[model samples]
Target: MLRGVCTALAAVSATGALMACRSPHEPAPLTVRVDAGSVRGIAKGEARQFLGIPYAQPPTGALRWTLPREPRPWSGVKDVGKPGKDCAQGSPGPKNPSSEDCLYVNVTAPREHHGSLPVMVWLHGGGFTQGSGKDYDAVRLATEGKAVVVTVNYRLGMFGYLGLPGLAGSGDFGFADQIAALRWARRNASAFGGDPRNVTVFGQSAGAMSTCALLTSPAARGLFDKAVISSGSCGLRWPAGGLFPGAPADRPYVPVAQGQDDGLAAAEELDCTGAGALACLRGKTTAELLPHSPSFADHLAYGTRLLPRDPAVALRAGAFAHVPVLIGGTRDEARSFVAGAIQYDPELITARTYPRLLKEAFGRHAGRVAARYPLSRFPSAGLAWATVLTDASWACSTLAGARDLAARTTVYSYEFADEDAPNVNGLHVPDVPQGAAHATDLPYLFDLGGRDLLVNRERKGLARTMVGYWSAFARTGDPNHRGAPRWRPGTAPLSLAPGAIRTVDAAAEHDCGFWATTAR
Candidate 1:
């Protein structure tokens, strides 16, 4: 059973009345007949929204650990008035309950246009542990960008990612769920007046990691033409995290004594080993084990066909899908993660500790990496740490992915630098201002019907520009527009994280310099 959240319906103006009516007994709203069922959605001011449409069969009992099954045919039109319950995971803040039956999608489209429009499919980030497609609404993005926007809910946590011995495979099942959702879009997007052929997959944080995985996996090769990864990097499979296969005692970072077991080990601890592991886990109740769910970074399973090796290795070997990509990171990308590491104050980030941690993770390259981004050049210890981490984790990873892809594909790179990007959530450290922190770019790309505490009017204008660029990219592989500045692919090392808006040639003016400066 799915849990319910807040629900309300607002009226539309006379000029837009036709877009909001759903039936003759009521009004004529946006009506679309999907393959599994039909939906009637109302126009919410600028955009028409259809919410809570299931894309796959509910994974219950015997269906657990198995691949997603096709959604069952419904007898009548489904009421898609409210967004579905998020995947079965704890919310970051005060929100809703978690459940196992959350494989649904929500779509928003422009009102005036009728033919097949470009579509942007969103995959929410929670490190494959938390977050929901419903948490984000696509009103602003669809209306302003004039493209159909789709947000999806995929499996998460142990239910979604656990790779037991008896399970089907030893990789990311959460990612598999997303691929299934995209398949759903390819099959039924035309009903919503969207062009299935022109699809773009995008996400932030853990969602970005998922995007990177999709780019390399053969299963997701033809699903999307373009991708946008924000604030997450690939490579570095720590033994402690359990994504890779190396002896726990062989790695210094492994804290096996801390009870941080990998999915395999966790299953063993639960007395579930070998082929019957799926059945063993299914017998347990949701309440009996959730209080002790694994951390977001804990890798449920890997070393499978879906992910033959780490994504960074795949990107370097040129084994990924050859698709045009837009990759970027915020100025203060790691502040959120830093904030979560309490007791480790900004002042505590010394030259000794910084290099020590880096050495442990990077080994021989630690000194070289540290030299490129020394703490001595920054304003404060926190700022220096944030800069290096943002660059190393997000900026550099994106640059590497873009540069490698550019050898055979088109790749544009960026670094968002808006400092006062309203972070009223108090999630980041006070010293580490949002400064285009992790996910600040999302609101500008899509209008979810409410003001994100981190945005205002000036920011809203920036949002329009950003959405315009994204929409153009969805329409055509290129992100160029009539009035906007020309976007060039990052082909060289110096141009990886170029200033905010550097022109492909002279005759144009953009803010590429601002991005490059903060990035450095």
Candidate 2:
């Protein structure tokens, strides 16, 4: 059963009409009909938000680890005014908790809309172990961009990515859930005043990886007209100790065999390794299963129907869908990850330790890497290490992916380069400049934590510019429109900074040439 809502009324205008601003996990009051049934939502300012409309039935009990089934048809107006619980993952504090019964999509459209507007569906990023669709409030995107926005939540970690030996949806249940949501949006977009034919699927980080998977999946063809990938790339790879002081090398995807191996190992740890193990695994409580979630992170598997091959392999073979793609990443991409490690152990990346760290990760190439990014060239050793990883793992890899994608389709690449971009992740290390690090570009496109963090007028203006660029892309296949800077399609990514938005040689600046000679 769905949870009950606690309502708090807020006056919309001076006319004194109250709008119930309830918890996202609870239901709301306005009604709209879809294929499955009718669902009621809330009138939140400029957007009429259909919070927590189930796209697929909850993935629990007998359904866990299997493909997502279509949502069961409902009778009357299902009160979805309240948002649905987030996917069972490591997300926020207990106040806004996560749950296993999460397979919902929140529709945000103009409160006063003439039907048939373009649709933009969002997939949130939290590695593969954390985060939710609700964390991003799409009011800015809905009203400012004048588009219907859909934010989705899919299963995560063990519940979503676990690949049993002969499971029906091995290694890619989360991918299936995303495809199902897109199918739902395509079917019911007109009910929410959105055009059924025009759809844009965009995401960042893990969400970006999901979008990449969608582009390569035959099952996802025709679901979206265009695609946007941010802070994640088809060729994204991490070297040994690239993420932290001593972390192992990693990539966003693994083979289905590897995924199955990971799942089998996890099941053994849970003592559910015999026949009918899925049923036995499902019998465990949320608390009992969560500790093993991290083990399944970044485990989106290939060699399955949903993803026949790795996205990078598909990109190289030009096997992906031929659609316009907007792909980019922040400037100082790996600063947060490095800073987080230094935060835990303050002396983790000092001058003496930095050289040893690089040698451990890169072996003979350590000398070459250190020669390019000396501590003398940076404010501190931590920043130096971050710069090396950022250029090699993030900026250069994304640029390569963009070039590969552009070989077949229209691809508009960009680099978010705001020097004072807010540290949205809250990871702070003294002397570490968070210059547009990782997800800092998110606030420019969204209001994180339901609060607008653009305190400065200049930053807020940049936010509007970003929203304009994104919405324009959603409306047409191109992001270029009147009043915005000319964003041409090619290899060079448009550098996005206040008063400095223009094409930049990200390869030159990030030293991709040096990395081209080095192992990624």
Give the best candidate by TM-score: 2
Model 1, CA-based lDDT: 0.64
lDDT of each: 0.64, 0.86
lDDT score, candidate 2: 0.86
Q: Write the per-residue lDDT of candidate 2 for residues 20-81, one digit (tens) a residue.
A: 22232332235667888877778888678888999998888878788988999998788777
Candidate 2 segments whose C-alpha is farther than 4 A from its true place: 1-30, 91-96
lDDT of 1 by residue, 1-520 (tens): 1111111222322222222223223322476677776677777876778898899988767776577878998866677878887777764334656677888899888766555678889988766777888878777788777788889998877667665444474446677788898888887766666788889998887777778778887878788888877765454232110121121211111122222236567667678777776578788766554543554243534346566655777788888888888776666666655544423454445555666655554556667657766777765545556665555444555555566778878887766666666563356566555566677666666543354543356776666667777888888877777766566767332111212445222101122222233321
How many Å off is the CA of 405 in candidate 2?
0.6
TM-score of 2: 0.93
